[model samples]
Target: MKSNNTLTFSRRNFIRTSALASGGMLIGFNFFTACKDKVAPPVDISQLNFNNFNAFIKIADNGIVTIFSPNPEIGQGVKTSMPMIIAEELDVAWKDVHVAQGILDTKNYQRQVAGGSQSIRFGWDALRQTGATAKQMLVNAAAAKWGVDASSCSASEGVITNANGDKLGYGDVVKEAAAMEVPENVKLKDPKDYKIIGQDIRNVDIDKIITGKPLFGLDYTAEGMQYASVLRPPAFGQKLVDFDDTAAKAVTGVSEVVRFGDKIAVIASNTWAAMKGKKALKVNWQVDSKLENTADHDKILMDLLDGNSFDTRREDGNVKKAFAEADQVIERTYESPFLPHNCMEPMNFYADVTADKVHLVGPIQTPAGTARRVAEMLERNVDDIHLEMTRMGGGFGRRLYGDFVMEAAEVSNLIKKPVKVVFSREDDMAAGIYRPAIKYRIKASIKDGKVTGYHLKEAAINSNMYGLIPNFFPAGAIANYKVDTANYNSNITTGAWRAPYTNFLAFAEQSFFDELAEALEMDPVQLRLDLLQNVKGTTDERIQYSGERMENTIKLAAKKANWGKKQDGVYQGFSAYYSHNTHVAEVAEVVIKDGFPVVKKVVVAVDCGIVVNPLGAKNQIEGGVIDGIGHAMYSDFGFNEGAPEHTNFNSYQLIRMNQTPIVETYFVENELSPTGLGEPALPPAGGAVANAIKAATGQRLYKQPFIKYIGMEEQELIG
Candidate 1:
């Protein structure tokens, strides 16, 4: 099942101690405690296998170092950055290190997911320890060879040196190092000694990417792989009744037509043929009357807004008392529509299923999850399923779900042939696990000039909007605070998209806070700072993020943006939020031109602790900001009669080159452990732009895709 010409790295080449005895070092570092199944037999760890280690670092006798980048790369630059941490600690040059994408081996690389912006957050300490352990082993080996004390020998730049000026390369003593036992506790390098981490290292695959090399999911192929296109139900709640393949089978290059319950697949020799065959498929679907359209779903959400069924996620002092005693109470409702991921590369997976084994290769955010799903679907053992990950063009939390991976596996399992199921832009758009639309109602109590109370009630489809993060910004800062959530069951499928709840919640909360500040005639930036300052010294158990870190990012952002400064034809808006253990604050500068909001510039300040790669970090911030702006200003997934109305870019509008704005990014100087870099910066961008639009025109957009609310003639704002 292996492709010789492919860039896929397999775990089959894992070096054992016997292989290492031939003058090479193979170090296995166990970072995670593996979950054991009671039904499965015990496994001996005496043998050096990839499954026994969380990650494997190999140094050949020729002095080539290879460190496995365990997680899938979805253009977050993890492949370049994660290995950089290891290379820094290994005392090797970055150029000497070969960063290989690790295969799915949960016994070793457990919890290998690319979402939540958590790769660096969780891998920071464990990966460093891995490298440090290897370095200590090498240092010990070099000392034993030189007949010197290990403490007297120091390692640098892949070489060991003693006080007598005797030197030996790491490769010379690697065989000896491989024979030594792994160190239990090895001291990691200080931040001051980080030569590779803070430096601006280009992405590892930059050259291949720029030169049009094949590395993405769409580029993956195996021997005799046939392209496939599936024809799913036309609507969310519909099911396929029957399919006529008479016309589809007649198409050129068409091979076979397969049906599996509600889905029908058209297999062909090539992608175009498969697409043509799919279009020719006459499939009849039975539609469900319930959950027919977006409007109907909106009504359901609105009804649940006041429904009696509610869960009190977080509550403090009496909210009723604060509101009753307040001089005035301000209430507002915000609405956000469902959104499609629209990754640069559409969904696709290649599966070659035989009686004994199921082999899959594609772009997936969670390979381990996909493997488990395939194993369950095939009723096979988990060890028999081999899943390989390719470089994804974009993830944005869309790949977190393994439905597409399962589809390919099931199709291959049934057909008994190698199949590559490719999703057209329309198919990817229509058949979606979209970001759930939400309705949020916020009420604030104002007594004199200080805010006394804050309450938020969110109504979403299938699940609550604020599940894990009930205590958001101003949660601990407000005396009387409460959060209520309700869900409206529907047929629409929903999954995590980027920052998940915070993607849209940050917009609702931060924009409402702006209105609260305006009502009190207080500066928005100053108001957030004041609120954060209140919780800075408190020992409140409700605070999830460090109050000092949050406050620092806010102050630093304002200082960088020149908060009080004014420019001609430009209005500024401020927003701050914390998510994925990262705090971000942003200020947007916009100008109204021809009745539309034109973003001129954006200033972003993040406190994600120590940034691993400055260049990649800035790129992530800029990309996330632009993406947030695009979604806030343009993106919306619409449905009519239970069918997705916008299926392609012709109907769906995305951010264009001309629409991109200048984004200035700054990272607060800190020595704390690094947080995520991909998603935190995105949430605030939406609110910042919305607030900017409000400042430009005396209009508050309560609904998302803000273009729907603005009018040219009268500027009538609508919710």
Candidate 2:
């Protein structure tokens, strides 16, 4: 039997095991077309001895060190921070290191994933060891050359120096180091000795980005790359019934129109022609049923929540008995609409497929997974598939699913040529796969100003598909606690968003806690603090979150926000949550301007252990907070007849720069290992803002995209 807490296969293990098998030293650095004037000659990478180190590090004869970041860089700074771990242990100067993106190779790199913010958390030890192993090899090489003990030589600044002060750069001894066997137990430098790990090093690609270098997926090109635009089904669950491609082929520069299971593609010499050709193609869709509108889905959710049957996720003491015996009970129903990721780059990918092999390059979060899926889809061996990752404008968990990547591969295979599939803004927005709309009912029983019992029932379209563990917070803290979930089947695609379930669950639970605090006649901060104290020394090993860590973050955020002090024209709300192995507490200050919630400031405290880069971590928190606020305030997706009603930004609202708040972040200083910071700061923003809106307007916003309940005209989900 499998244990609930059993660790699963991870990418870090793959890299570590492979590195150790090669004596803990990776060889070879893979380079793409870096110069425009001269095309580099193709060399058989498989024949190079340097291929052993392909995924991690490469040192050139000029002493320039290159580190390949295994995970995709979806604008969360993993490309920079992951290498910092290895570079720190290697005692290398950041300025001398060149960062390169790694290809998807499970045999070499392992789990090269960018979602769930697990890159750093999982790669920390393995990456440090990779660097330490290499550093030791360089030291051993130098010691052997000097005819001295390896222990007598020290490595620093990418060079090894002896007691006599004679120094050899890594480049000078790399060949010798490569000849030496890798040590199985190379000691890593202590955190105190780190020069690059904790520093706020600037992004390696900043210069190239500012200088207009072609780095994004859209900017990439091949010798004979043709642009292709696909016309997907109008609504979810709809299938392509028929299509006439004569009109599409008549369009200037239109090459051909190809049909797939779910969509019709138009390949053209240019992007505009492909788009226009796609538009010109006459197509029809057949729906299985009268397109289920948003109202129908909402009703389905409500019915599930009210049903007696449920998949019990977690249960402690008798919640029914505790609630029945409570002094007072406070309950609220919260609903959140479907949300689109709207990654700035839009969905685009390039694929070149032939009978022998396939090569794909694009902005994807899960390169290795995509490679495997594409290989399986195309009936090809995994080794025959090559995937290259580009810098993503934004992931927000949208790129984790490789449906778009598969589409590109399909189109390339159909056309028998290199093709780039680009989803126009409208196509991207209207295409399904959104954050699942969910409804949460949270009830709390308060007795003598203490929470006695708590119950949460979550109703969602295909619940828990993203591994959103139901008992996220306040689970082990409350004595009489229960979590139940109901799933409603639907045709629309649903997948992970930032923080997944916690993003919306935190809002409902934390906001309800505010109401519970009111019922108990206690401060909101104090109520959470008391709850944390209640679970401090519990013997429950199943409790995933630490009470002490949560308490520290909560206290720090309250202190930073001056929790109880009165302010002019501003009301404060406090919320804390733990997700992705990181603890975050946020305090929001808000005021009603023209009857709309105008957030003035947000004070965030994070405990992700030892922050790899303070500036990057802070920026991630600020971005997560703003993103959470934007989604909570103005973002919502409504489907009419199974299709997204809002096509683009004109109808679907996003947070504007003017609406952003002044965000200040602080991290708990500790010697513990680091966790991910990509998503933890996002969950509490909705709750904090909603609670603040209540303080400002005396009205509790139970529905998401709170703008609908404000002075703005409310829009219904039905057609």
Candidate 3:
């Protein structure tokens, strides 16, 4: 089930070029026709002897092609896949093409932030056009040399061949092409003709990564840069009052201690010295707000759900009337606790601030925004700031916030020197932005054994679900539907963690759908298929998910997992969800061991459009499923008196190697532009696992960290 459609380029407005100083060709084009501004050349164009070239592609006289990947690499594999799209259209050999991480250049790139898993979807057209236009220019140049029409020449594997079979390498004609006019409406390759895109291209940085190269932010360093370790309030809602740096300054290798807005920064020659100095400092703090606890959060969230004040997200077909007239009603509430991202490499950033200019470098998800914020904080012009992106060990949405980046810049500005701020694992977990605790209450009204009404209420900490989420799956499927949301603001910082609201919301909704199927005495797969039929051919603009795509995904997953087939000791569960413009379905197979449900395998099917790289796409799906299962079954983070209860792995539980299940991935291949693969696969995993546990043990788990509901101690689960 793969797409064989050919992509056609219609509008080609922004096509420009400049001759490379090395007698090569530089092609620059804008994929977004709406942006009328002329493409600007790179700031270091002359220094690098490479012109704008769309700031994406560069060709050398040695036949080597370099493509620049503009987005942040958060292990989602965009760095590899993005260039593959360009090389596919550019018609170049991947082995001869080198991929480089582009610096922050807002003038040449848009939507460079990497949080939404949209790097490819947004950059697809632009990247392809860039490569295709370059290839066209090369062909035109070769045609001119042969005194033949461009149509008589065809390019493949970086070589242009004429109808007579005579050929010239791209580099041989690059100099002539550099002086030629930029072509408009260059033809893009058909999907069926793709060679580099769908092939198994290893991550470009794989060699460097395995060889211990300095590609991550934690490995970034600057000449004469000092290391910094900061100490803030021990708990949320607490503020710094006063701090004594006498003992801290006495520590070996301790250089100086600086205070900035409720936090103390200990500067030293090395990270170990800085952390030691920070530990020796004496600080006093006062509670500035309510010291909230997990219990308090639970009570407050539940109360918000019960209260009348709520923001109505969506409503249709008189839910009250449908519920009142229904023959039966089923309701369930699901609860989840806060969770930390726990990225492998702790939060770290490098900054050098001076009166005239600012240099900031690190693994930041939002590089442009962070640089702008730094400029505003220092009262400097944005142009004076030069920011570089380093590969991130992991983001999971934590790196989206620039607080750590700001810390490095602020400290460097205060000291008037270069500094690298490093956060210990404890600091990362204790003070990091967390996935907010959330509770969902779903109710369904059944009339004549068919779902007739649906109502959903969400209560969260700090924020509610995004407005468009209410219009996702199950919205158009059910006739009478309503959604309400309320939130309780807490001083404890909370924000997007991976899939954001859908990560947990899918578990709640999908689990409820399974229960509803039981009440109706209908197979879960059949129930979903029936609901999807209601939304088929739907013209509702508010419905974000395509019924056709969801159905295909669910069917593929079920078929692959042998859904509804009874096995001697195996129990199976199915869950499907749509998020980030992608439809994904998963089937979990469970087996009991020592009175505990163990997930043995998970079959995942995704409709993220044509996967750019099957290997990378499969890696994303596997990682997401494992993450979802780990968090749902073992990981738990709670706040006690405004302080995180678990600060590191020793206390915070994660699914270990032996507990991981086998993941089988399948993609519904289509010519539709790829949506998001990073987070969509995760949202359905929790629900699939939860439903499978229910089937295995006949116990309905209403809360996350299912280990808590089972009669197993934390140690036993860990073992």
All candidates' TM-scores? Answer: 0.94, 0.91, 0.96
> Over 4 Å off in model 1, which ranges?
1-22, 34-51, 106-109, 289-291, 464-468, 712-719
**Global lDDT scores for all candidate models:** 0.83, 0.81, 0.85
Q: Which has the greatest TM-score?
A: 3
Tens digits of lDDT, candidate 1, 1-719: 11111111122222123125445776655433332222111122234434445566778887789877777899999999888988988889887898787777432344778888888887776667667767888899889988889899888879889989899888888888877755555677778878998999999999999998999989987889999999898888788788789999999999999998799989998999999999998878886556367898788888877677788989999999999999889988888888889999999999999977888999999888778878988898888887778999898988998888989998998888999999999999999888887888899999989999998988987774324368678888998999998887767788888888799889989999999999999999889888887787778776887788898999999999998788788999999999988999999999988877889899999999898999999999999999999899888876887788899999899989999999999999978878898999899998999899889987788887877666533233323
Candidate 3: regions farther than 4 A off = 1-13, 31-44, 47-54, 106-110, 464-468, 711-719
Backbone Cα, N, C clashes tallied per candidate:
0, 3, 0
Pick out the ten consecutive residues of candidate 1 with the lowest summed lDDT: 1-10
Instruction: Give candidate 2's TM-score.
Output: 0.91
- For residues 146-236, write the lDDT of model 3, one tens digit per residue: 9999998999999999999999999898888877877656787888899988888899899999999899998988899999999978899
- The total number of steric clashes, by the backbone 3 Å criterion, in model 2 comes to 3
- lDDT score, candidate 3, position 125: 78
Clashing residue pairs, backbone N/CA/C < 3 A, model 2:
11-111, 26-53, 27-53
Q: Arrange candidates by lDDT, highest first: which order? A: 3, 1, 2
Poorest lDDT segment (10 consecutive residues) of candidate 3: 31-40
Model 1: lDDT equals 0.83
